[model samples]
Target chain A: MPPGTALDIRDLTVRYGDTTAVDGLDLQLRTGETVALLGPNGAGKSTVVNAVLGLVPSTGTVRVLGRTPAAAVRAGCVGAMLQHGGLPGESRVREVVELVRRSCPRSWPLDDLVVTAGIDGLLGRPVDALSGGQRQRVLLALALAGEPPLLLLDEPTSAMDVEGRRAFWTTMRRLADRGTTVVFATHHLEEADAVADRVVVVAGGQVVADGTAAQVKAGIAGRTVTFTADEDWRFAGLPGVTAADRQGERISLTTDNVEATLLALLAGGRRLPDLQVRGASLEEAVLSLTSRSRTPIGADR
Target chain B: MSTLFAFQLRRVGRNRQFLFFTVLLPALFTIFFTQVFGAQAGAAAQYQAYATASMVSMMAYGALGAALGATIRISFDRASGWLRQLRVTPVATSSVVAVDVLVGMLLTLPSLVVVALVGRLVNGVELPLSTWAGLVAVLWLGSGAFVALGLLVGHSLEDKAAGGAIGILGVVLAALGGLWVPVQLFPESLRALAHTLPSYWYAELGREVVAGDGPALLTVLAVAGFAAAFAVLTAVVLRRRPLHAVAG
Candidate 1:
């Protein structure tokens, strides 16, 4: 483990009976970095977060700020918002926050936490009376009560509406800007794209792709080009074009090099009309990468 | 830990089910049993003895019910994922359990006082101040075993099942422990069976304290042994089934 690293997980494996939830996963995060763990359902994203929080028993080691996960928790250096956990329904919102604050050695002021969570109106309401989105905010307040240096959130916005999601990310951005190491696991591709500085894509309990958002997108096959042209069999033979299809006057081509394909199309004085270029979206990139047979594409470390 | 205990206490204070079992029912039983038996006993001294015994029995019932009701509360917390949420914090599991036990004991106090007051004011039963203190102390400490039993049951069963199980266990234990009727009124064979239960020892302790004599050494040892055994069983259950297993 390197000094100053916010989280270091090495060869972590979690199993349930004969099924493996997380298999030999290794990941590290530096201080002040916001990383997203992205995967489809049953892809072990929540498992990794649970392992980091020491909530599940797993083989191998996990360290937060150069200490074991349990040690960091004891020092009040880690906070987590689990995917499906709920607050005490009988307790009022503020009282629940106060109860959590008492467990930490250092905690944010209750007023500040209430404001950050945007739960001022919910302070006096019983937890059971709150809506799903409101309850999530209360849980968020409890997670922030410790004011920990490391925050691990597993699908924190799954229960939120559009407005709630936007407000939640705004709070997260502020926390990350204040030098808190934030690692969140989310299946929402757009959420990871919008909020994460770096993205780690996991499939079948392994890190399939790891890099900045643009880098992970770029690591996928390539772009696509479409143009209006006469039906011809020769377009498929163009350089950098992997596949080509012609239907009437429209031609679509998938290419590894968009520049080279365009150059080839125009080099022959081919009058291509209505030409368009489209880059692969993050969703497409994830699908293509995970669908492969354990292909470690662009897993550059 | 104090905050957790205080929060739990406040929740219990508002819980209608807890109030019904721990306070209202016990007070009603104390009043009803004393009225019926005290009027029929004829002799003033015998009437006083019956009223005291009824008060003690009702107090024991109330304390045991509160301790077992704690299992229902814990089961709800576990089902709702609150217990698993707490596990992620810096609070130790043992500290949480300690707070639970403390809250259970606190819930018993109101019922104890109410029953004792009923015995004194309504039934004209009187005891020395020291005896009152000693009886309360014994009942309070003896409740630790039931608290441990609550924890064990909470961890072992699901939410609704746990509540039903604790309720049934409370009634059965009360019947066999001679808290509902005097042990002397039972047949020899039933009395022998009652002597084998931990509840009997607790009831005997209360009787001895009310009779102006200290609890026997064997009774005290037996109660302590029950507490230790239940505590160990709780620990074993917790190990076999971790809190996160119930997480949503």
Candidate 2:
């Protein structure tokens, strides 16, 4: 309950019937920080966001700007763009934004909000007539109409085209620069890496890793070296190599020291064709961590 | 709240089907019923009585249709996630419900006017200005019960089913409540059964006003009671099954 904390969730658990969606999750976000909740499908990322927004029932405490989620929402302290559902299709874009603006006691200037959401050209169109990306921009405008300090977006750019997505991020970056705290849930690792100052990876209803984008990627030990060679069990026992797999003529090795592993491969005097070396991507880091946590030691042998 | 109300009013106005149901259908029914029934009554007084009754019935039907139309729109909005979006804003749930009912009542006005006009011009029905004012007032107030009924149906059923159900219910209620035929013409037992319905009291309010007698206190109480009961039922259902899209 600090002044600078934009969101505070402690031991939050959400259950639907017998199934637990989010299990004892805890998270905190500071003012002006842009964080990404990164996870695969059904990893409880949406549940956590819903719990914070009070859209879903939860057992533990969730506070936005030192108040309950509902209170914060009513006070115009929080705004969100859910992954699904949107404005009523019959109304024009400007009308919908005006409706949302009327709900709050204080709101951003109408023209400013329209410009920030990039919806100036879309104001006259009906909601159902617009394409998916255009509708999303209208929803964003509605969310930002109140000029809330904390914004929560659930897969906000999922429907946008490449250019649209890029433009959306540019707007988001501007908002963040103006000291708005943003927490968005997305499975797009590249998006998280590009936009988030911090990333929280959830898997199996738990936070598997939480750190800066580069730090999380660095958690996975080394680079991968793939080459076409005769299938050899000796590669698995080579120095600095953690694991090795072969698919027909192609061999892939996970090595802690890429330089030493390369030297050893060349010293063997075997023909190595189609060699490819790459560092671990954010996706790989998350996959490796989640899979490792699910598998017990000695079971992988 | 005023802005939201205006937005809802605009939405209802733009819907073609709603306008047809609220104005055209009721006006046509008024003309047809007045022509068919107005001749059967032999005396001039009898003709006045028949035309007045027909006018009230058609107006009630129109108001009921408008109320149901509003309910269906609300259900569609809930299913489409618009309600969820509103819930996150500073607007309260009660504000939305109030606006919906207000819009429904406002939409019913055209239907009432159309039916009254047909009764006056085509059927030669006549009443003092005060009587007309009283009838319009009671009829408008009586619409609250049907609005609540619409809400109950909307919250309980899916969009398609709710529309069909309301349509059927409207017809059944209109027949049983003595809107189609005067309750006095029915057998003693049938008349007794009709009197128990809120629609009977609503029609009675219209009949009493047209007869130059003020609305009966018991009828007013009965209509108000029905309105209160329907409102309670809608509130309970909405609380138990908060509006959301049904997952497939």
Candidate 3:
């Protein structure tokens, strides 16, 4: 409820018939903060976001800035880029932006936002004619039309390619820098790692972990070490190393203690080539945590 | 509600495709049907009544389609996550549905006028002052019913295709309800089936009014009741399903 906190969700739960889509999830975002919600498919990340927007019903409490989602929307406190391209077919990119601007009492200039979102070249194109990445940009432009204090995005870059995704991340960071509180939900851990100042990993309708990206990585408690050796590395007896394998010249090790393993390897007089120790990439962290907690997304890896 | 209403109306108006389907197509059909049936005297008389009634029904039916179109819009929006984006925005959640209904109404008005005019000019149908008033009343009642029906259809269908299927069915109901020909011409069993339909009730009321007869007050009551019932049914369904994706 404090000023600049675009969203405050507490113990939120949402159910559809017998299925509980979101269970006791808590989330918060303040101005200039870019928060990423990371989870595999079926995680309640989207449910929580929808509940905060008032598009879906939820039990518990959700306040946007000091008001409920509906109230906040009327007060111009939130902006969103949902899965559906906010731009309708038959509508030009410029027209959609202008329309949203009209709905918003305080609106940004269409030309300026068009350029900022890198949609200057797409202004005259009908929404349906644009490529997926272009449509994504237009959706962002629509959401940002009012220059709302809070922004909610559900897979903002899911349809974009590598370059497009990277560009969108930069745009998102810029928005946060300009005082927009952003909460984005995505299945791609790498995207979350690249853009999210804070990451919340949701699974089985619950917040399994919530903190900075480093904290989430640390919570998983393992590092990946890949090195090349003459033969397969005998990692069966290594302490703190949970798993290890060799692929051709590459030796991969999963260890709970990276420093200790490195020291032990060095002491063994084993001259390893191309040895690299990584605490955990967002992808590794999510997979390990989800695998330990629930159904192993054996496929995601 | 006002701002949301205004915003939705404008947004829908900008959808050239939906606007064409909701208004332009129906008016063109009204003109075409009136011309096609202009020759036969009895058929002309029947057509006149049918055209008037169908025009009203068409508004309700098309309004229903447009309303469901909003559902399609929502489903697609959510599918890719646009609805989620809007949720974080300052737009009121209720505005989504509110705007859809208002857009349906805007699209409904022009079609109603086109049908009335075509019926009078091409079909030589003239009505008394009370009949004119009754047409207005029936259009409102029928429009309300279909609007609610559209909401229910939109909320209940998981696939956008199914939502569209419901819209086409609205047009089919027109033929079965005697919107193209008098229900009197149908087989006894067919007539009985049509009589039980809300579409039939709407057409019968339009026919009665066009004959310079004031429809029984009960007719108005029944139409209004159907509208309220459908609206409640739709709201309840929507509450349960919320944003489930419709068949694309």
Highest lDDT: which candidate?
Answer: 1
Candidate 1: global Cα-lDDT? 0.83
Q: Using DockQ as the measure, name the better of candidate 2 and candidate 3.
A: 2
Instruction: Summarize candidate 3's per-residue lDDT along B1-248 as a digit string, tens digits.
Output: 56546545655666678767766666666666656654443655676665555555544444444444544554454444444444555555567667666666555656566556655675555776666666756665566666666666655665456555666766666677766666778999988888666667765566566667656777767667777888799778756664533110
Tens-digit lDDT string for candidate 2 (B1-248):
99999998887777888788778998898888888878788999988878888898888778777776777887678667788888878887889989888887787778777888888888888989888888888888888888888888877787668778888888877788877777878899988889888778877777777878788898889889999998999899878775542210
The runs of at least 3 residues in candidate 2 whose Cα sits more than 4 Å from the true structure, single-residue gaps closed, are A220-301, B181-197, B245-248
In candidate 1, what are the lDDT values of residues A16-78, reduced to their tens digit? 777788999999899999999988778888889888988788899998998887888878899
* Candidate 3 or 1, higher DockQ: 1
**Stretches of candidate 1 exceeding 4 Å from the true structure:** A220-301, B187-189, B245-248
Q: Count the backbone clashes (under 3 Å) in each candidate.
A: 0, 0, 24
Model 3 chain A is weakest, by summed lDDT over 10 consecutive residues, at A292-301
- TM score of chain A per candidate: 0.79, 0.80, 0.76
Comparing 2 with 3 on lDDT, the higher-scoring candidate is 2
Alpha-carbon lDDT of model 3 = 0.68
TM-score of chain B of each: 0.95, 0.93, 0.77
Q: Which lDDT tens digits does candidate 2 get at residues A69-104?
A: 889989999888977666785788878889999888
- If both were scored by TM-score, which would come out higher, candidate 1 or candidate 3? 1
> Per-residue lDDT tens digits of candidate 1, residues B122-155?
7787999898889888888888878888888887
